[model samples]
Target chain A: MTIQRRAAFGVAAALPFAGARGQAAQTIRIGVLNDQSGPYRDISGPSGVQCALQAVAEFGSRGFNVEVINADHQNRPDVGVNIARQWYDQGVDMIIDVPTSSVGLAVNNVAREKNKAYINTGSATSDLTGAQCSPNTIHWMYDTYMLAKSTGAAMVRAGGDTWFFITADYAFGHALERDTGNFVRGAGGRVLGSVRYPFPATTDFSSFLVQAQASRAKVIGFANAGADTINSIKQAAEFGVTRRGTKLAALLMFLPDVHSIGLETAQGLVLTESFYWDLNARTRAFTDRMRPRLRDVVPNMASAANYSATLHYLKAIADMGVAASKASGIDVINRMKAMPCDDDAFGAGTIRLDGRKLCPAYLFEVKAPAESRGRWDYYKLVQTTPAEEAFRPIGEGGCALVRS
Target chain B: MDLFGIPAPLLFGQVLLGLINGAFYALLSLGLAVIFGMLNVINFTHGAQFMMGAFVAWMLLEWLGIGYWGALLLAPLIVGATGIIMERLMIARLYKLDHLYGLLLTFGLGLIIEGLFRNEFGSSGLPYRIPVELQGAWDLDFMFMPVYRGWVVLVAFVMCLATWLVIEKTKIGSYLRAATENPALVQAFGINVPRMMTLTYGAGVALAAFAGVLAAPIYSVNPQMGSNLIIIVFAVVVIGGMGSILGSVLTGFGLGIIEGLTKVFYPEASSTVIFVVMALVLLARPAALLGRS
Candidate 1:
């Protein structure tokens, strides 16, 4: 019999082994750690945490054993690191849904050092699976290189020749601009001009828009997100920049952002995404099941990713028998890493030992008013970038774990 | 380092952009300072009031065909009127209590306002159109500055000065200051001190609303807008020592320009550099540059 089935039966029978180390415990303890309150709070928070709980129940029937503990890091690197370390100390085999990039990076290092599996479902930095890659840390969501390749290169090839950037003046924005610049150049496109707006600066994109207008770039790339993107796009409309035939490409966006910008401004804009709410049968099924429990708000990609990672972690722990030493975090994590995942979110995805999980990326275009779709029907699939082609090539990432 | 025979011009243009940002910081910090001074209370809700001003202006235009000119005139009045009601019902009860009570109350109010708006509009900002009159750029041989941006700096400066002049020079201002120092004595003088205090708060909030109206053209009007900007303003206020009215204004503009220069040079330290400067200033004077000892 599989260890998962044993753990399941042990938990159901109310045996002492369920809670005791090495004893047959039916329940598996999984940690859901992410920013609950901070700058990144709205991006992923209690909603994602709750999604893991829903996953625990869904996967529980398949000889699954589960318990979930949540913590809010407030976007502090140290806070996230501490939460992760303590969870491992308490025999947590896996941690899921870490959001903030800097914080997520910090947690990745600690997870590798401790040998506890870390599933980063929310962070956007490419360094995680590249130079800073770890055997235990898996960056499950989108990154700048993917965004650049999928949006910038694809758009240029499809006839967005001249390019200009209106970037948020910061590290993240700078990285995005650099990647997109390379993609534009590689596509034989002309680099027209660019402007850097101070972070959190009010929306006045007039000077920036005027600069882009003067450059006559066919596409004015906005290397910013959140309020910055909303303001730049809106002001671009006000200045008639879009009407002047300059398309705006938002490098990163979320469903909430689309709702705020509305159809008039967002229509015909092409962007890349790892997941969309209504993308496939699996995605629709997950959202439909989560809606009743979640009080009817559609499940976003972050929440879905959290559910998939948490369930897979539990299955792995049950597969590995509860020997006292085996109950130690590193031992359990190693066991999970050896398994293949087949779930609702990413059906048949694998969690590699080096922690670079694989998933397909989708290129989506914002729908126009004539589409006459309901709310949240904002995006129509343009193309699906296969999992292998969607990300930075493994050979080029230079990750130490790729060799081992 | 020179391009197009315009080294000085480039420096001058960057300086002008710095000054433009300074004007905004000055106006926002000035509003925070005024609200703190009159009520002996830190209004954490000031940012929400500012956001409310912009949203009110947008709703008026989008729903009622009020137009930009009309919103510029009416939005502040509408928001200030709401401020008066809030002050009477909620803030009035907190006087003679620890000042933190008012701060906490305002913070709660800020959350409620921001939450309600977030529920309706989400985190992204709704764009407001700049008036047609303010559309073009002014080419001055050195830099092409947007006309609306130039106007924002000009009007913000005038508004800050007018606020200082009214509070420091007028008869009503003297009564307000007197009440701040000794409300019991001022009330004994048959001045309706409570009413005066309430109006003082309303007016201070009105200034924030006015700044919001000006901001709607430049920034997206969003629920989180006020919360994001307010934290920095708090840091600005702390650095200014909230000492005197003029002190907050000057410190705000000075620090904004300093931040802008940081952007031109290092760029990475631009955001946290203000707080770093605040720490150094605190170490040197402990009471801020323009603050009282």
Candidate 2:
């Protein structure tokens, strides 16, 4: 027993020397934190972890070992913050795909304090880049501001001017309603009134739908997401609110939401997104690789963003060499900002001063049942907002990183 | 012209919607009261059974090509049978222990059922189309009332009434109530008290499943569907007195209408309106509205 103990101690003493000699073999740890079993699971759960693995595979690890770990934040801000702090302490270089905006902001603060990177793919609040912006955080995929700019402005331009909002009562929902309201007012549209429903609990939207119908708003904006968004739209159809000619504009929607609502009920609804699986050949290829891993469900914007942002993060690390790990989070983020982001899923894009991913936003109209050719063929692209104009301008964002 | 500073049409329309919500509350709360009354077990799996009812209905349509009418009949039987098996295998074992054990066991069962469904089908809700016959709406000049919603309220009222009649007037209900009062005496009277307990639990579960089928078209059919509605139903049960069948039925509908009215006037308090009422009722009479000492 004593000899065995000595041998174990001898092996442990040699491990450090071996690890020092093979420094290039260091593992790059990436943490994927988001809702794994809640309402947002289908949007960016295990599929998100798979997306990050695909990025590592596509990047070939660049002579360094890449490891990916994931945990379910369960949509709780405290759970998310605790996981993020523990991961940072355990040498996790970055965290990706946090969905809930409240959780996303909490994790962002932890990453900021720890000087680690946080690539936010699931959160929709523009506050991530606005009031809560951090050099260590990258606001990837879509945000409320871009969604409002694409869907809200486009709806007003199409003559549905008068508006009423059935908003989910939360940080993400309020931000979406506020941003969309701004666009409505900016487009010479009249603001009627709005109602805020309890988040996740209020399934029946009949009374709220009645209020919207009575107000006679040309567009009844559903400033909510996931199950809430689908429920509002379905209940609205049942109540005959949509049949009476009031358009239902979903400000924030994902591919999974469209699929769940089905094409028949969701037809003619206009929404804005940063990624669509059928957008182009490159997107199709990326989606093709991810579809089998995602159990037949197509990649939504959040899962797709996981692939794009991780690839770009790796590219930045590859450009910076071994010194990238020791450098502060800001230095690495600055390096990523300097580099042009070109991924198959999102195509060519760039990170702005406010850390918002600059990608062209597409306006998609849900196709009629007769127009759809196959499964997952939901969106028909209506218009493309340029990369520069799609997101909130850097100067306008209240990010401390941006000059006034 | 406005009524009390709000448009008259808006006020009436909201009241109508409130009545519809109340119908669901009544049906679910009635089921809870029935199960708790006989077995003295809270049957925390009520919500999961409700969710299963909708999923089973969807599966019936998807796999067996059964329509709404078929689902309305079949889902309750299937879910009720499952409830019988659960009671015999798991819940029956906890009868000798404290009542808290029964509650904990059923709560664990609810989690297992919800988790299994969520794993099989993702949390994103699947849409169930409104039946073809009940598709259109009635334009009452003040508001457009969907025919299907109207049918739901009418059917729920009739179901609650029928259930009340069965438990209060029938001979079998007399045996069941006698069993609740003294199981030993009911057994002495040649009644199979254990079997009666099993059937009573099954019947109560069937009631919840029936409501689930009715709700499939109105709400998105998802695993978490029953969970959200169950908490509100529990509050309704408490406010009405869990012991009184008619009391639960009344409280359920009353709170639903109050919640609907709150939405029109104070939208923010709509969700918590029932809880607020529950607290007020507790303060006024700790025994609940119709609860016995």
Worst 10 residues of 1 chain A by lDDT: A1-10
Candidate 1: residue B185 Cα off by (Å):
3.5
Model 1 / residue A150 / CA error / Å = 0.7
Q: Rate the local accuracy (lDDT) of all candidates.
A: 0.75, 0.87
The residue-by-residue lDDT of candidate 1 on A1-404, one tens digit each, is: 11222243343334343456443344456667775543344455666877788878776554545566677776678888877776665556577888756778888888777776677888766777888887666677577788888999878988998899988876567778988898899889987877777675444455566557666689999998767777777667655677657788899877666666777767888887777778889888877888876664566667777877777766766576544323455565556567877777777776555556677778889899789378678889998787777777787777887777
TM-score for chain B of each model, two decimals: 0.94, 0.98
How much lDDT does candidate 2 score? Answer: 0.87
lDDT per residue for candidate 1 within B28-112, as digits (tens), equals 8888888787788898998998899889998998799998889878988898889999999999999889988989999999999
Task: Give the alpha carbon lDDT tens digit for every residue of A99-213 in model 2.
Answer: 9899999998998899988899999999999999999989998899999999999999999999999998889999999999999999899889999988778989999988898
